[model samples]
Target: MRAGRGLLAALALVLAAPGGLAAADPAAEARAAAESLRAAGNLLSGAEEAKDRVAALTETVRAYEAGLASLRAGLRRATIRERAIARGLEARRQELGQLLGVMLGMERTPEALLLLHPSGPVGTARAGMMLGTVTPALQAEAEILRAELEEIATLRALQEAAAGALADGLAGVQTARTALSQAVAERRELPRRFAASPDALKSLLENSDTLDSFAAGLARDSGQGPAEPGYALPPLPLPVNGTLLRGYGETDAAGISRPGVVLATRPLALVTAPAPATILYRGPLLDYGNVIVLEPAPGILMVFAGLAEVYGATGEVVPAGSPVGLMGGAAPDAAAFLKAATEGGGSSQPETLYIEVREGDTPVDPAGLFELDKD
Candidate 1:
């Protein structure tokens, strides 16, 4: 009976008191993320000459971005689990000492007596009876502890491996972005719209004080795009891979609300055209930062702001998924990335891309116009 109690105590000492096994397999998720990276690497191996090089590299860059995001998420999960287990062990340090004592006592006692627990004839019978129930539980809990420790080790190994892969990923995406930019610059096959009138655009840039005013000017131009009045927008991808920072009508830290959705994009991320659109204007505009104004259909104009570099000339009709610009900011290198992952919080997306849609002259919410990406 006493031995049984000791075993249970030992089990209690090692057993984590918080949540049980996580419902999702973060390791599996990490592996899936790695697979995505591998795919990107394979596609980019000789991507410069692929017939659809521009499109291929575009997808490649996006794949790398999405994969890296997934990897970050997985690393964060693994780190959090490892820390929780460590905290559990640290909290029960004294209990663990007692557990050692129990284990040592078990070693000294006779095997038959260990099971029988010689309290007395009546108590002995009861201990033997309890043994049947208790032994399996002790083994089970010990196995659980072993598994948890192994999980910590696996997580640590994963983070270390991710460092090299993440560095390579960062470099790879940058290379792809550079290639995509050149490809877009050389591209001349896209259909054309009327060239932006420099004097008119220049006047608008100088006179317009707000994004709304600038957008309204560029959109009202008759030759900006094919006039299809009351065009119902189909769900299209957001210009960049990102998470939603602020939705339309959401107030920010400054307590200002806008009729636009703010997306938090990774540094130097590529921004692609969501659909076929004619570039009405592409340059630094008002307070919105580097902006690309596209009239997808007459009466519907989309504005992408906060870019580091803009591609294509005004009046170039770009197809869906065409590279239009790059997001502003600098990404962390591998060392910093791994350090952040090991530290167990998460990575930061420093660049903000503000997207707004105007239907005719009215500023409308853009959230439903684009399919939002969670990663």
Candidate 2:
């Protein structure tokens, strides 16, 4: 009974700190994310205004994405830890068996017989002392064995729980996504910077053959007043929660390279503006799929492409951290997520965001402009 109770404590200690038992622990992050998820869920279900609902659900979806990532990392460590403990036990099987046998013999032997050593009182005293010393050592190993088993049970339970939390989390995220879409459609509070010229936009779309030409057209037509030369940008985080998969100028299989960074993210991951920017355009463009063109400063264009959905309107000035869109691809259900999590790096993000930073029609590396360690 004591061992059973202590097992939880042992598990907690192991998972209490990030990078504690493993080189890359995520348990602590996962716990914090779980709390955030609950709060966001409550806000999503609350009777907030449509505009507020959009904001809440946007953040809620992001929280779930981050939480799911953390859960994946945590579960991997637990699986590895369980297997390591089991292997260690197996390696010591013979020694442990001998210890158990000695312990059982000691328990059953009468106290009088143990004291009446054939050698004499002094010899008997020495033998008794040796038994006393060895007994504790054997008991200690048994306790360790019991504790390890308990930890294994806890790890198994954590995996089982992964299914429930991940399922509910994914489902809740979908609900939030639906709610966000409706709320965005109903949103009318955002003030427009300028009215987009439908004719110019249509002509540009019809004539442009590549992303470069499209961006150049948008830059010339974007109604942003002027670039403030002193508009200093603070260090920025990525527009979405994702892993940086390709750097600027990374040549692909065809030996062709684009002057942009690429990020890989889970399906339906929420993307936000890295800084306050005026939306120059938002829609499908030149095979890039759903795209957003933003004028962050004079002569500076921040283009985010390959989205599943785009929010806001052309010429709308969206604030920093405002949800802009969601990444493409079908989100995995809870069971699928758990299965992939346990498989050790099996879950590869299928959705990719192509990010381009343009300065006066020329594309350049934006990696230095944002925090790279965030991944």
Candidate 3:
């Protein structure tokens, strides 16, 4: 019966041993969440070129919210794991203290002294049995102590990892918050398109059936006034330096066809005017996020979208290489996204900007206009 109890106790210890069982990795999950957010950012970059700025903004906000949610979930998991480990550690500490106390008592009252101090044969026999029982119990406890020590070490390492994950999650949330704030501020700064009255422009925008109609309306309004002198198309520069994610007419992962080129740039990349141009419009349009439309010549127009902050305004003329806006950074859950992308045989996704060129109402290839070798 005693042996059966001992076997059961050993089985229980094996089952309860720290780091002995398979468990979810909170750090890995957090990294995965980050990677997903990066993918969303890539899609948002393409969405910026969509004719509807409102839809693009909505998508962008959704991505940010999703990223935040993922980070929060990871953080919660880490917190729970940390607490569980801490509780186990505390119980182990108490067990260790008791074991140490028993060891000390045995050391002070040596077996040799016990044998020497026996009162009679009857007492000696009882003492002998006590010594036999105490010896095996001490050895068993010593083995348990060793296992507990290892378990404690494992728990400490896990706690440290959980703490690191929590810190990373908090940092990612802050970055997302800052990016969102900048986007909102830029949207608020855009001037009303129609000069006559804000209500008239709002009404026109509401009544417009399509994006092309809206574009045509703006062009007609600009043409109604005195004609601006046509300027030559100078050697244009790329707005921001980065990898070309997708070219004009290419379909993105979301299956949406892009009308312009998408550049995957570093976080907070500076977006500049490609050529000397007057800003025709600078604001959020229906699906494009924070758009900046520039008229470089009488018939040619350049559009930049997916900006977190815009520097120029409507009717403001800027020279080539002049700062127009800044690209947004990755959402807070970026770490996971980068890791997953790298592991999946792809590079990390970064802030994306969309560039589009047009001649009148027809879209033109942006590739031919920019001097790619110059920069």
Candidate 4:
């Protein structure tokens, strides 16, 4: 009986060791993860807002420059070259009138006014003939006027040429303004995206040493049980409301297993968390566009793909139903991802959303969890 009791005690210790190792508190994991996810989400959210402001400012600067160029062009077009010519012609006409008055002696003697009329009837006819003969003098005056007018015309031409060059310069300034605005916009966008650094995440995933080290610290006080059966796990709230153009699961064009689900929605729609979780990774994968991976619990991970912009960071936690990032097609309404050729003759492209579930190192049917709650 003593030997049997000792053997039973040994067996009990052996069994207890495994349980202790596997023991995890789901609630605690969820809380810790949720906090990380939230931080990641906030970082992303702030970045996105900054991006929007920059974009708007860029557009405004472009518009202002455009209007400025147009105003310059209009001023050029409205300027008159004729005014200069008119002033030159008026001066010449006044000089010719004075010369005629002096030649006719209409400006002196006993009857200066009478000189303009004639001395008598015979003189009147002679004066009339003299006036008619003044055509030669008038012709000479006109020749001088024409020469002066030509000079004025040349000056006017120069003015127009200068205006055209000024207009060109203004156009160049406008182009530079546009380029500068766009550059600033891109510069602003680059830092947020660069700082999060998807490449770092991919590296971490590839060589788990660093991540494992980090995870070790997090796991020190870890309390979570073995993963529960993934059933009726609510489909992650789409960044925006829209139809799912493509369902989860299928061979992609490259003949690779479509790793996750796709949710089709409008451009820039906000993608949110499916459940409380921590961002295990926030970066890009080969086929995934702007990927975000959130671990809700041990053996359960959520992935978001084809993000126009990402809003989360590694080591950040989020609450269930919190905003992850916005969904984006091409514009306000369009699909971002193309469709794979169907087995049937016709082709189908859908705005797709991808989700995946993993248990340890196994890929299970994600549909099971999504389908369970469908009404």
Candidate 5:
């Protein structure tokens, strides 16, 4: 019978685990909350930057179109060099015809005759000298043809180059425009999701209300400090290894910034519920994908995002180390995150785990409270 009572007590303890854990440092929690805000802010900033780039691309496309139009206009006009070459070639042909008349001993000899009988009468030194004299005129005609051909080639090359540049510029403009349009659409949608986010945040802040209210009762019973350390509380274990890609705090990405850490984790690593608590909400958020919120204390809310699955429902309590959801099945996983550390070599993995602690509805760094494994 005593053993049965002990088993019952154990079960109750398991059920009561939500209130039992979390003897952590408030400062660390604050930092975690702050980091969450920062991450959201960064994402919002990125979205704005994408919009700005779209504007720049639009301007560039306009400039490219203007340049293409100008090039087409220039191609229509004949250059002075081309006209000179045409005239020179015609004069050479006439001169050759006159020379042929002198050689053929006829009053009117065609230009073709001079070429055919370039040496006039062979087997004589005078024939060789006459061939040399006509050679210069023929060479001059060849030069004219070559010059005219070169002018046409230059114009064609410029036109081809300009066409390619315009094509590339237009493609860039279109891509940027699409991205900007997407940003605007998302910006409009996020407020509704974030509206509940503040409620969750409010719940977290209210957890501290116990500190002030229960402080009096606890002090009357047993003397206690005004603020107790949260370090002794259970640590929120990470489902996967990764670095803090974006710290908690106001960060910009899609359109608005919200509270949370953007962890660069293994692509598809499972994200589990940190502790046993009643799930307050579960659904898709604006920027956060497949989010789940849990209320551990009266006002202490834990928000989890970038999930593939939601194990528990709102008002359902979960245990510590519970598998809330697995990362990456059809969608990309937050587990596999890569940070850009170097310009050429690329980013390196961090040794420490990525976690954010929040207390009194504010963000704090999680590193201070937990004893991180160096290995």
Candidate 6:
């Protein structure tokens, strides 16, 4: 009987050990989701093209929304677990109190008094055995109480971390909302290439195979005569403040060589006319998103591509520093850019704008002409 009781006590102590009661980390998933959303926001803020801006902002918003959902779900799970822990802790406390009470009563009574009273030797012997069994059981209960206390502390910390994440998620949503609003507003103000008859222009575009062909056709149909000579290049301002991502003549991953300089800038960065110029074309062309071609001088053409939006219309002359368009800034999948940069052994190219200068049909090196230091 004593051996059986001792074995039970040992099992109880093992079950009450610290490792036995550990719960899974409640905040891990939420933390990961928050980090992903933050990375997406960083990429979005680095975008510099117009066609990419709305799409990027929309993705940022979606990520924020998803993060918020994850946070809420984490809070709910934490709340439920907290309630369960509280109930379990309370029950353990009550059990501990009962055991302590009995132990205290026994301690107060003298051993001599117990031996002299009632059933004498047999009663005292039985009491001694009971004390032995109770002592081990009491120790097991005390260990369980300690473990529960630690568990509660861990849960509270997880809850606090979750709350902080939730607050950050809310702030991200607001930032995304403001960015989206600005992008939409800019799109609404942009001048249309064919405001009088868009259908006629669409028909003309459908028949043209290349952007240059389209520009020539439009000019001929509009009755504009051949451009005159004697035009000189003006001092041009940098379209955006950024680092050169890729220079002319550099070949990219797909074996395609760049014909112009590609600048990587902050998301939604304003693109302005470098010199007083007339817009020759403004629209999507080939793989480029929104493109804007300008004539700063006769026979010298400046081309801006990979924009999120274009501001001026065909044949409209605009002064230097006039807002030509905006760079795309939406970071829909920042991870992809990061992965590509890592795998390609290159620096991250977040938002990029391609600028090409042409003399007739021949591409020119714009690096020699533009004073980029002023930006």
RMSD for all candidates, in order, please. 4.1, 5.6, 14.9, 34.3, 30.6, 14.9
Model 4 poorest ten-residue lDDT run: 333-342
Model 6 ranges off by over 4 Å: 1-200, 215-231, 331-349, 371-375
lDDT values of the candidates? 0.78, 0.73, 0.58, 0.43, 0.40, 0.61
Steric clashes per prediction: 0, 0, 15, 36, 56, 15
Any idea what lDDT model 2 has? 0.73
Query: Who is ahead in lDDT, 1 or 5?
Result: 1
Task: Estimate the overall C-alpha local distance difference test score of candidate 5.
Answer: 0.40
Candidate 1: deviation at residue 146, Å? 1.4
Taking all chains together, each candidate's TM-score versus the true structure is 0.87, 0.85, 0.42, 0.36, 0.30, 0.42
1-375: candidate 2 lDDT, tens digit per residue:
233234334333333312212222344444555565666567666625544666676777777676677777777667778678777766766765555455445546676885678889999999878766765554565456566676676666556656766677778788888777777778788777765689989999999999899888777777544445656456788998888888899886778788898888888888899988888889998778999988777778899999999999987888888889988888887667777777755545778999998876778788867755435
Model 1 per-residue lDDT tens digits across residues 62-155: 8898888888888878777878878877786677667666766766778777655456688877877776786677767666765666677676
How much does candidate 1 score in TM-score?
0.87
- Model 2: clashing residue pairs? none
The residue ranges of model 3 lying beyond 4 angstroms of the native Cα positions read 1-200, 224-232, 330-349, 371-375
C-alpha RMSD in Å of predicted model 5 compared with the true structure: 30.6
Give the range where candidate 5 is weakest over 10 consecutive residues by summed lDDT.
335-344
* lDDT leader: 1
Off by over 4 Å in 2: 1-33, 47-51, 115-118, 223-231
User: Candidate 5: TM-score?
Assistant: 0.30
